[model samples]
Target: MHERTHKVNAGSSKPRRPAAAGRSRRAAGFTVLELLIVITIIAILATMFAPRLYGNERREFR
Candidate 1:
């Protein structure tokens, strides 16, 4: 029987950058303009559908 041994060289490994330092703030998430656009779209959709939803409920009660 033969046994083999492996050695790791920690010093040769590349150093990692800090999490915050590795990425820019803009790249991490949506911008203010993008968020506002999405919120506006959602509000518009809610306004468009809200009346129909409530109208159906009122008729079911009568």
Candidate 2:
């Protein structure tokens, strides 16, 4: 009884790899369209706010 229980416990304790492999088999990285969308959003935000911040700096100098 003790030996059987020990074997069961040891088997359960060992990490299983099939489940992990199944999870990682799918595509994981970002697509090009996603990267382009992020870049475009950043560019638009910078354009919208950069001049106002720079203008404030110019006023401080003057």
Candidate 3:
């Protein structure tokens, strides 16, 4: 029976950044304030438009 062996090069592996560095990079996304602002804007727009949309539908049925 013959055994197959594999060779791995240590230098080929990528260097890992520190955990804090990774968290900072990942944290580049939206902050709580930014997310809240976006959600508020969406809610405001929905409130402004939703009633008009439903009103038009009701008028069409009449």
How much does each candidate deviate from the true structure in C-alpha RMSD? Answer: 10.5, 9.0, 10.0
Q: Give the TM-score of candidate 1.
A: 0.58
Give the clash count for each candidate.
0, 0, 0
Pairs clashing within candidate 1? none
**Over the full model, what C-alpha lDDT does candidate 1 score relative to the true structure?**
0.87
Q: Is candidate 2 or candidate 3 better by lDDT?
A: 3
Worst 10 residues of 2 by lDDT: 1-10
lDDT value for candidate 2? 0.80
Q: For candidate 2, lDDT tens digit of each residue in 1-62?
A: 45543334455777555666865745687778999999999999999999999989999998
TM-score, each model?
Answer: 0.58, 0.56, 0.54
The local lDDT score (0 to 100) that residue 5 gets in candidate 1 is: 81
Off by over 4 Å in 1: 1-23
Top TM-score model: 1
Which segments of candidate 2 are over 4 A away from where they belong? Answer: 1-27
Best of the two (1, 3) by lDDT:
1
RMSD of 2: 9.0
CA shift of 34, model 3, Å:
0.4
Arrange candidates, best lDDT first. 1, 3, 2
Q: What are the per-residue Cα lDDT tens digits for candidate 3 across 1-62?
A: 99998666687776655679868866779778889999999999999999999999999999
Angstrom error of the Cα, residue 11, model 3: value is 42
Candidate 2 residue-pair clash tally: 0
